[model samples]
Every structure is written in structure tokens, then in C-alpha cells.
Target: MSVLPRTPPRVARRGRAVPVGGVLLFAVGGTAATIAVVWWVAAHTGSAWSPGGDLAVYRDAAQAVRAGGSPYQVDRDGYGFVYPPFAALVLTPLAVVGPLAGYAIWTVLSTLAVPAVVWLLVDHLTPAGDHRRPTLLAVGTLAALPLSPIAGTLLLGNVNIVLLALVLVDLLRVRGPQQGILLGVAAGIKLTPLVFVVHLLLTGRIRAGVTALASFVGTVGVGALVLPADSVTFWAGVLDSSRTRPPGEEAYGGSIRGAVLHLLPEAAHGVWLPVSVLAAAAGLAVAVWASRRHEELTAILACAVTGLLVSPVTWYAHWVWSVPVLALLVARTWRRPAHRRWPAGLLWLVFALPLPWWVGYVLGWAPLTEPAWMMPVDLLYTVTAVALLVLAAVWLRRTAPAARGCPR
Candidate 1:
């Protein structure tokens, strides 16, 4: 038998060099993009904002713990400590740092999360050996960082990025005993992440769901043990009231509740609760369908959007979900020609542009005291969330003939 000629060692080495080159390119690009975005944000946002505004709640609460005071009694500028008491325990270390130092550390961490999240999304959706993956990730991070929601997250020092990391890392992991603990702790810190527990259940990740529930309860128990009176007031009273809605926050909040309350007369405000419930139910069903189809990204997006829409208050800062949505849309449309890709482009433009300006313009003409902006910019977020849920529903239904029947 004739032996096939062996490839030259030089040729094999050249093949190896290409991917190493790709890796190096990725590292340099990612680092450069992250630095540029962070610097731009810092330079533009002069020191006019409240130093550690949202973070102050945690820091102040932690300082209270240090002072042997109750965290629940803590209120910074009329915004009481809304998070579970366990979060105060977690944030106690930051209390040691001065305000400016804490703000700097928090900003840096949130800034880093922007690129890290973008990288994770691109890495997940893009296939291995695609030469464009690293470049796309770096470029996408650059593009996403300046969007209004992300900008707001950084400026306000919100915990949404940390929350996003907890959910995404848990979702990306292989099924295991330790899978949902982080998510549970995240929910314990902020109640919104509990929706992911529903996601875990819908996806048939029963063990993970249980672990998450247990972890969440563990936080509550820890809080009760550490400060029983504060725990009682928070769980019993503070959690489900207008008090949890911060002062003047309705104008900035973008939830369905906010939109409905803005759109309708004062007499109709009560209608928002039922409407929110229905929207959440429908959204979760769509997430469940996405899960059944193994569309993990779609499912996560659906659940996150649902949580944002249904939450009593979702300020622009809470919309860290938009980053993943934009990245996923980019990954889907990158290979398509420009002519066939306008839908993704349109969505990206809607997000990437300063759509917040529209909100401002509309509100200026018809102050939120008047509801006319709802016809224009006021309902923009609520509408976008509904559209995404519809898209997820359509995607799941169209992909599987057996699943065409409406989900209950």
C-alpha cells in the first residue's frame, strides 16, 4: 500500500500559530476596548452625581451593622434599605472604605462587568474556530458600554451588573449540585433574581432550583438571626408597598407598572397589578417554551425581560439585560448581508442610540404629571419587552411542530 505523504512540521506549526494569533488579538482588543469605554464614561460624568447613591444603601446599612444599629432603620435620602438584610452583611466590608474609594471600586467593578458580560455572551453564541469571535466580542463590548441603561448602571453604581453575572455564570455552567447557589444568593440580595428560580424550574433543573430556593431562604434566615426585628419589618411591610418604590422614581422607572401608571388616569392606577400579573405569566410561559427547546440564551433573555417588566420598579440602571440582548442579536445577524439584517440592526439602533432622549423630550413637552408621553417615549421599554416576549414565543412555536399549540 502506498503511504500518504506526511504534512510538513512547519505547516502544522503555522496552523497552530493562527489560533494563538487570534487569542492574542482577542486579549489586546478586549483590554483596549474596556479601558477606552471606562475612561470615556469617567471623563464625561463629572463629580456632580451623588457619591455612591444606590450603593449608599448597602454601605450605610453595613455601617449600621458596625454600629450595632438596625439596618432596616437606615434610609438614605428617603430610600430605605430595600434589599434583604443579608445584603447588608455582605456589603459590610465596603463600609470600611471611604465614600470616594468605595465609589471608585464599585465603578471599576461594574465597568469590568460590561466587557466580561459581552465576552461571555459572544463566546456562548459563537461557535469555536470562528476567527471573528474574539474581535466581535471586543467590538460588541465597546458598542454596548455607552448605551443609556449601561451608562446609568455605571453612574449610579447599581448592583445590576453583579446580579447579571450571577445569573449568566450559573446558566452557562454544566448542570451540577452547586449550580443555582449563586443565583439564590443574588435573589436574596435583590428579590428580582427569584424569577431565575422559576426559570430553573421551567427548564427542569430541579436540583438547581431547589438549591437556589434554599440559598435564598438561607439569606433570610441569616438576616433573621442577625436582626430579627428588621427582618420582620422588611419581609412583612417594606417589600410589597409604595415605600419600596423610591421617591420620584416613577419618572425614571421603566416597568409595565410605571408605564401603565403614567399612561392612565390616577383612578386607573389600580389596574396595573392585574396587568403586570398577566404579562409576567405570559412571559414566563414563553421562557419555559424557550427552555424546552434548549434555547438557553433566549430563555434567559425572556426571563430577565419578564422580571424587569413585572417588577414594581425597574429604573434604567436595572436594564443590564439589554446588553445580552444586543450581543445575541449581533451574533445572530453578523453573518447576514446588510439587506437581510435590518431587523437586528433596528433593534440595536433602538438600544444603542440615546433613546432616553426621546423620553426626556416627551416628558419635557408633557411632564409626567401629564400622561401624553406614554403615547411616545414613556411606554418604549414596556413595548420593547412585550415585543421580545412575542419574538421568543414565535421562535419557539415555529421551531417545533409539536409545540405549535399555545402554551398554557
Candidate 2:
């Protein structure tokens, strides 16, 4: 018999095998480009930034925990390790490996989140035999790699990706007694995801919501056992929101509060609080409306944006929720008519381009020189967040009558 070349093997995803050799190459190339871009930022950012500062903070916290000390005690006011005590307990292994090894592991895990998120989106939104799924997942992964939020999260060693993944999985796939476990654990690591607990309750997912609450308590109990002092300090509000880094023009701190601070003035800063509250309430109401109509992705994303807007601080990395937001918009509108699809394209450019960070970088240009309106451009992501809330409300209102044959 004539010798024959073996066929390339396929990888299994949600029980379906996909021929994804091209995607692997694209992922590798995209990662190399992302690394090069980070080096460029390191060489150019001057004293304005400390590359890997967040990672350093994490390592320091881990070291403190490893030494049988409190991570809270090591805070020196600048760029502190601001996560919950349970996070420090979970990160203890990073101390054992040391900084360099820990950083490498972190990078691999963070990069892997892009594809993992894409896979989850694909598996949930598209049918198993959909011919376009592999391509869409690969393309989405590459497109997400360089979003200001995603790239910044990688640079900062933030837990946003893990939280995003946890939230996505819990809502999209998990449907049993274990459904809420991931979201609860995520909220334990960082409290922002508590908004999802609200999301679950209003959407009639009472069991999952209660289970998630229990899981959160479980994490806190574990933290108390492992690092009682740190847990006590954190629960007592040792890390106040006011002590966080300034929502200034130098970085992509694009919260609704940050926007109000920049656009108005110091005297107007207090307005952001009530503004955040109103925005969050409106966003949550829209989320409830979407969930009632079986618009699962819309409900989750509405809550995501609400959390970001209502947060005390929303750095560029916090916009990591954009990945799934984009994935959802594209999935819903990619093959529709131009009028229906154009919004997806516009939103893609909003994230895919470096516009928000460019707004930050350009402020340093002497010619620009503190023009009154210059700083608000840094609020691109923030503006998009607000726009999403409005869009969800309006769209849901218009579609309510037809969705599930339910009356508006």
C-alpha cells in the first residue's frame, strides 16, 4: 500500500471537534503583537506608569500572606492591592513561584481567557453544527486581544478577565444547583459582581441567586480561617473607595463619576454619586425588562455596564466586559441588513481602536495644553456604557410586544 500523510487532528470544544489550526497560528501572532505593544508602552510611558505595577502589588500581597502576615498591612497608599482578603489567600501560590514565574503564569492565564471567553460565547450562542462558529470564535479572540480594557488588564494583572469569564459561564451554561457558584466566588474575589446577584433575583433565578450568596459566604468563611486578620480588616472597610487612585486624565479612568469630575469641576464632583445611583437603578430596571423577555445576554450586559458605571473607580481594564458585549452584538446582527448590522461595526471600532487611550496620551502633548473639552474624550468607554443602557431600554421597549409573544 502507498504511504499516506496523516490528517491533522482536531480539538474538542463543547463535544464538537473543530479544525482550528489556523486559529492557533492567529492567536500566536496576535499574542506576539500584543507583547510588542506592551514593550513599546514600557519604553515610552516614562514615569507616568510603572509597568506591571498591579502584578507587583499582587506579588507583594502574596508574599505578605506567605509570611503569615496581612496583605492589608502592606498598603502604602499608592496603587494598593485593593481586592478582598480571600483573593490574597487564593494567590498564595504566586509567592512560592516568585515574581518572574508568577508573572509568566499570569500572562498565560490572562491570554487564555480571551479564547475561553470566545469559546463560551460561541458554544452558547451558536448551534453545534453551525459552520461559522470556529471562525467567529477565532476572530473574536484576536479582536479582543488588543482592546484597551483587555490589554490593560493583562498589563495590570487585574482579575477582570477571570470575573468576566465566571459571570459569563454562570449565566450562559451552568443551570443546576452549581449554577451560581462561580459568580459567588468571583464576587468574593472582587465585590463588583454582586450586581449579578441582583440580576439573578430580578430575573426570577431565585435559587441560583441564593446559592451564589451562600458561595460568597463560603469564600468569606474560608478567608477568615486562612487569614483572619486580613478578612476582618477588609470587612471593616480598611480599603476605602476614597483612597483609590485619582480618576484623572493621565490614565483611562472612565467611570461615570470620572466623566462628571472631568467634564464639570471639583464643585460638581458630588453630583456623580447621585448620577451613578440613578444610572445604576435605570440600568438594573432595563436588565430586569430584558430578562423578562428572555434576552439573557442583554440582561447580563446591562448589569455589567451598570456595575462599571456605579463603581467608585473604572480603569480601562474594568471595561473587560466589552468582549462579551461585542460578541453578543455581532452574533445578533452580523448577517442582518446593513441598518441592523451597522451598530455592531461602530461598537467594534469603539473598542478595537486605541481611541480612549489615545485621548489620554494626547493630553501630554504640549500643544493640546489643557483645553476645557480635551479631557472628556478619555470618557469614550464611559459614554459607550451610558449609551448601552439607553439602547437596552429603548430596544427592549420596542421589542417587548413581539419577544416571546408577550404583551408590552
Candidate 3:
């Protein structure tokens, strides 16, 4: 140490070490670029863009709440506002801001929060000495960002990102009473996330499942107690609308069911419901089997993604939620030293290719196209969805047993 501090052995390297500053620059630069692009698209498109219809709906609901009207009571031309009143109450502050400002704030928060939540989940899953792996996981997550439907979701002002973060956070915790409470809260915010209760049951976490159900029921009870007559009216209206809403109006891109129907005009749209049910059942069975044999969070997430895909009403923007699962799969697959690089390469391709298709749709290229051009895009969509599903299945098969034995 007296002789020039002995040239700290760790600093003596044969190759150039990665500069932390450079890494930070890259991350910040990339995020900035992405934000700029989305902002430009949102600003220039203005009211011409229809992809963010959900955002419009949310904004409208917020306005209604601020106007001393029940969001549920306000008839939104057939797409009745069905979200819990608490959601509108929470969004009241955002409503005070104009739509553009509110959307911008929401987009930034969602984009930033999602990755951070994923990192936390990964950290929880990894072993003590494996802390370094979470950074790799985060990088893979970033790489998959382009594929995230979050762009569409953000543009549309969907609350799914927050719902997704809550679900993922709940899943990462060891199955317990508190986990149930988290699950309940997420489900109460958005009912679809309630599917995780079934997942817990399938995974043999009966106590957790019961707890989640109880929490949901408790929340509902509280809502009923506070809102009373309004709660009943909301439930009735939602049920009526959900049962009777016309097709095409509700179907958005990104759902496997919707995508398949959009791709196959010859097929009856009603077929989608049955097909979706079958797909969901099959996916659930597979997920349960995987969980029983391997217990990997990625596998469970893949199942959840599959369920969303098979659901009849899922929109393209909701697909952003799958990006984290896809990223985790890529990271795990890449970790296998002997594995060929093709899988990773293919993953990148799948992640990047569909984005242009979405852009094309937004630009009205697909709708304006002749049958020939439209057919190809539809075919491509079907192929990509199938490919992603197959890849998820393969990953689940590979990671299940290892995850089962993993000390969480």
C-alpha cells in the first residue's frame, strides 16, 4: 500500500472493463430516444389515432367523476364504463390535468415503473450469489422493449401497466396471506388479473388462493358498502354491456383470438369465443403441469400471457405485459452456454418484426391495402403468434424442473 497502493489487483485487467458511465449513457440515451419517438407519434397523430381508445375512455370517466356524475352512469355510446369507482377516484387527479399532460405523465411513469418492478421480481427469484444475473435480466428486458405493446397502451391511456406491475409483484412474493391481499387489490382494480387466483390454486398454493379470493370478496364488500346502489347499477350495466356488445367493435389486435379472426375472414367470429375458451383451458393445464413439475415464475407468466392471448377481448396494447416474460425467457435461454445463438436471434426478430405491422395498421396501410398485401400481414400475424406460443411452451419445458428445486 505504501508502494503506490499495490496497484489494487482488481483494477489490473487484461481487457478493457465496461465503463459504468458508458452503460448509464446507453440506457439513458436509449430511453430518451424511445420517449421522443412515442411523444412525436402521440403529438402529431392527435385525435386521428384510434389505437388509444382506452385512454379516451379513462379520460372521459375522469371527467365524469370530476363533474359530479358517476362514471358508470354515463353511457359511453355502447362501451359503458365498467371499472370500479375507486379507479375513477384514483384517476381524478390525472383528470384535472388535460388529456395530453395526463397521458404523458402516465406513459413515463408506466415505462419507468414496469422495468423497475421486473428487476425487483427477478431479484426476489435469484439466489444470493446470483445478484449479477438480474442486471443481465434487465438488459434482456430492455432489448425486448421494442416489442412491448406498452407504446400502444400508453398512447391509449390504458391502466393495464399498473395492473400488470401489481400482479407481477404479487407473484414474486412467497405464497402467503399478504400475497393474497396484493392479488386481491390488483384483481379489484382490473378483474382479469383475478385469473392469478386460479394459477395459485393450480400451483398447490391453496391457502394463498383462498386468501386472494377472500381479499377480492372483502374489497367488493367494501365497495358495496360505500357505493351501495351505485355498485349494483354498475355491475348490472357492465354485465348487460359485456353480454351484448357487438363484435369488431370490441375486438382489438394482439389477442390471439381476435388476430386469428382478423386473419381468417372466412371463419365465423362467434367461433372465437369457443376457441378462446379451449385455448385458455389448454394453457391453464399446461401451466399447472409446468408449475407442479418446475415452479418457475417465467413459466407461470408465460401461462398468464397465453391466457391473455386466448381471451376474446384483449387488445394489442395489452401485449406489452408479455414483454417481461419474453425477456426472462430470452435471458434464461441465453444462459445455456452450449445453446446455439439462433434462438436468441429468432427471439429478437419476433420481437422487432411485429412492431412495423402495428405501425402499418396505425397508418391505415393495412385497411387501405388490396387483398394481396393485407393477406400477407394477416398471415405474418398468425405465424408470429404461433411462434411465440411455441417458444413459450419450449421454455416452460426446459425451465420447470430447475425452478421447482430453486430456493426462493
Candidate 3 clashes between residue pairs 3 or more apart in a chain or in different chains: 52-156, 55-156, 149-320, 294-400, 294-404
lDDT of 2 by residue, 1-408 (tens): 001111223423345555667767776677667666654554465432334567777888999988887787665335566778899988888888867677668877877887899888877666555655667776888888867678877776677888899888888889889989999999998888999998998888899999999999999999988888778788888436754563353233577777776667664557978998898889999889887877777788899999988887787678888888887777656557768788877887877555344436634553333334334444887889989889878877775333462211
Flag clash pairs in model 2: none
Runs with alpha carbons beyond 4 Å of true place in candidate 2:
1-19, 32-50, 75-77, 246-252, 338-340, 353-378, 400-408
Q: What is the lDDT of candidate 3?
A: 0.61
CA deviation > 4 Å runs, candidate 1:
1-51, 246-248, 353-378, 400-408
TM-score of each: 0.82, 0.84, 0.78
What are the runs in model 3 whose C-alpha is more than 4 Å off?
1-25, 48-53, 73-80, 121-138, 237-251, 256-270, 335-339, 357-400, 403-408
- What is the clash tally of candidate 2? 0
lDDT per residue for candidate 1 within 35-61, as digits (tens), equals: 454445444443323234677677788
**What overall lDDT goes with each candidate model?**
0.72, 0.74, 0.61
The top-ranked prediction according to lDDT is: 2
- How many clashing pairs in candidate 3? 5
TM-score of 1: 0.82
Question: Which candidate do you rate higher for lDDT, 2 or 3?
Answer: 2
lDDT value for model 1? 0.72
Q: Which of the predicted structures, 1 or 3, would earn the higher lDDT when compared with the native?
A: 1
